[model samples]
Target: MPNGGSRPIFILSEDTERERGRDAQRSNIQAAKAIGNAVSSTLGPKGMDKMLVDSMGDVVITNDGVTILDEMDVDHPAAKMIIEVAETQEDEVGDGTTTAVIMAAELLEEAEELLERGIHPTVIASGFSKAASKSEEFLEAMAEEISIDDEEMLTRVATTSMTGKRVEANVDVLADLAFRAVKQVAEESDGYSIDLDNVKVETREGGSVNDSSLIDGMLVDEDRDHPGMPRRVEDAKIALLNVAMEIKETETDSEISVTSPDALQKFKDYEEGELREMVDKVKEAGANVVLSQKDIDDIAQHFLAKKDIFAISSMSSSDIEKLARATGGTVVTSLDDISSGDLGKAGLVEERKISGEEMTFIENCENPKAVSVLIRGGTEHIVEEAERSLIDAMSVVSRSIESGKTVAGGGASEIELAMKVADFSDSVSGKEALAVRAFADAIESIPRILAENAGMDPIDTIVELRSKHEGNGKTWGIDAYSGEVTDMLDGGIIEPLPIKTQAVSSASEAAVMVLRIDDVIAAKGEEGGEGPPAGGPGGAPGGMPGGMSGGM
Candidate 1:
């Protein structure tokens, strides 16, 4: 239709949508910024919480960035990219999600300014990448190396992660519990590495946060399979099972013709004998407690109770793994070859009822490699938040131990890195230098937002930070409690080194990826439903981007 009055041909379907050039950039940037701002106020210790309500009337109240993003239905592709940043940060270090998303948003914000000045998207992306690399270098140089033995430092790092959550009132207790649980499961190898899976959390309501305690072994949320079984077993020799205790049924259908009454009696006795033999094998293996990954038959339960064995059915695989580690036992898949050595040992196995729920406790294990932290609270919401807070705390603590390094928290590390990155940008010559400088400005927004959320003057905070960090005091950060600039290290505000570096690395990468786009091509579904493919309006190829020199 362009050269003259000619018939137009379509490369895509009639419902396809496309936004090209500057309009596409604006649309993507606006969407990313909107999501960034949505989670911005949940940044630091003074940040506010969000109450998310679902269609079924289920509500989740949390300030956790990943949780909030996961709950929201983000339709735009650009916004979903921001969510990925938060998810990656959470998965990598379990904290600093808000910082990562906010940085990505601010980078786009700065790139918009450059876009208005006629700067190319590629140039902005290049500058941001360079800036991000410089920031990581600066942070690595600024970090302090510590070992797993630095308990107080680890405690401070744990407390920092749970600062603004609902369980802050009992943070000290929870922090200590998290650290100890991680420490108990920490094993020394080529170097000190902790498998976070070893530290399990069990949440139950109707108790104060102070009631939270660390169990020496794994806690399973199931009672004994039958009431007649012993409530507690001392010096428990447990058999971890992957197979069921039920008698097997033939896969193919068969007809059993009982020609006489004695023949039917013989069949019943044979079935009872098979059930007795299964329980006899467990007793022969010296297993006083039985935990199975599959179901236990009613007849099998009677035999186990008659033998005074405490057993649980339908145990999850994760719990079974933890139990093996805790009890120093191996899981037996088949009953045909289980020996006394195949059993696991625990000093005591008991079934206790707490808050109307029965839970089996396999405690008093010797040299246990796995541990549990029971999280208790006054209500269900508080318990949920407390569990989330504990997870964040435990994750940070484990990260600190594994990395053997940490940084001063409370925005000190961010402002210092920003200062260093901005100065590094001076040596680069070109429009890209502006983007690099923009990266510095983008991350500095962290401290500004921190001050803002804490009810302080952001401008004053940034100015003072720049002054103090000019030639000295890199560890100085805004003290929300006192509303003044103070040394974070001296104030015991610390964070794992990986969290900060991962945040900057991921945020900048996501920003660069978002910046490199000049066109958005979308296609509608067969039913013409709205989704990421519906980001832009349906249109023709005639709306091609304007920056190209050749015809399409």
Candidate 2:
């Protein structure tokens, strides 16, 4: 109002939808809360799975937080922000995606209460930031330094991740395999660095989940391309190629016209010679097994098979790299570069029928730095879920090894941190203390939901947990399977400290980011399309908010 009251000046386009003040904050908080509530039930070992069917009716059945959020066809911008929290947690720690999303939702929920009580969003954000920072210090103090030699504890970390994954009867075996694969590929340079990508996973739907096995080397999906080739190569010498074995075609568009039949016969003979030369090059390199990124012509395959060379074509570039790491071989780009020195070695390169499909297994490389895990289950959905479970298990194990720190799981860490944070909040003065205390309560929601998901009474569980930790029971927490409060450490429930810290930090950041927003503007998309594609940050996130107070 420049003078008293004039026409409301509109800086945005006429069709934009805008929300301001409490209304905007409320909308964002509600959307975030909805997302959290959606995944809260899938929290603990006894937690149930969600079966999400997309618009195309593609079904995904699992409790993996990031996967669920990823598969969700959400349109709300605020809800999408919550998904970012889960994505960050997953990308950083590989586990704790659900915990992170749930924490952010609870934080916003607590902030909503503060907002109603007239606390500024900035004050709440500041308090939450302080709480998150202090919690990190507390968590570090609580963590016990672990080493790779702590195999039993590492196994426990993996087992804790897979507990509620609808996994097979042999969880112990699966956990062992997960950590084993991590150990195999675990490398140390400046510090402990584990390339999880080096740990290859293949899922099969024939055998039971217990039948899953970890291989010492890489697994190629395609078997030897020709039947005449040797099915097994002992002391195998592998030649990895990125070039095609067929005759090279000209780059330009041209046509060949032969006036005589002899000319065409000469052309065919030259092509045959070129293909034979390609096979001869591989044979000259003394490569018993051939894996290529491009196709091998039928004539070349026939010649290679006649030479008793095991040949597989059309492999992904990733497979080629994995084979290089597994077999200690070099990838030769050109046929001329195919030499004996360039070949990789494996104790056995064999093709075996797995679930009615023949696949190649390159195993027993000397001190291999890469490996594969063949995950098996009786059904397709089970196999998919097991793959997800194993990913979580392997991720926790690797994070544990790299950080060399461990914490008691089963809500033990969350309860103790909440108490500490609550005490810290009381030391603070002013309205900010309320937001700090709110953060403490929000973190406690983790343990509360864990209990709830386990079919136990959340109030009783929290009460018992608080009582246990009141003295010096930092490791005391609920056991999801037994519905009993006990020492999580002694019960073989543990997690990497990084996972917990990352979840808390990311959740707080997301909550603060969402809370600080008091205005939302969704402008029309550029070129006058549907909405907000070319629009600035003020533009709609995906599409305009429904029935906002504006032209659109």
lDDT of 2 by residue, 1-552 (tens): 254586666567787867789878877777788788889988988888899998888788988889999997665678888899999988888999999999999999999999999999999999999999999999999998888878999999999988888784668888999989999999888768999999999988887888899889998788888899999999999999999999888999999999999999999999999999999999988998999999999999999999999999999999999889988889888998789999999999899999899989999888788899999988888888888889999999999999999999999999999999999998988998999899999999999999988889999999999999998999998898898999999999999999999999999999999998988887665565554433233434322244332211
Per-model lDDT: 0.88, 0.89
**Each prediction's TM-score versus the true structure:** 0.94, 0.92
Q: List the residue pairs that clash in candidate 2.
A: 525-532
Best by lDDT: 2
Candidate 2 achieves a global lDDT of 0.89
Instruction: Score candidate 1 by lDDT.
Output: 0.88
Poorly placed runs, candidate 1 (over 4 Å): 1-5, 525-552
In model 2, the runs with Cα more than 4 Å from the true position are 1-8, 251-263, 523-552
Error at 113, model 1, angstroms = 0.6
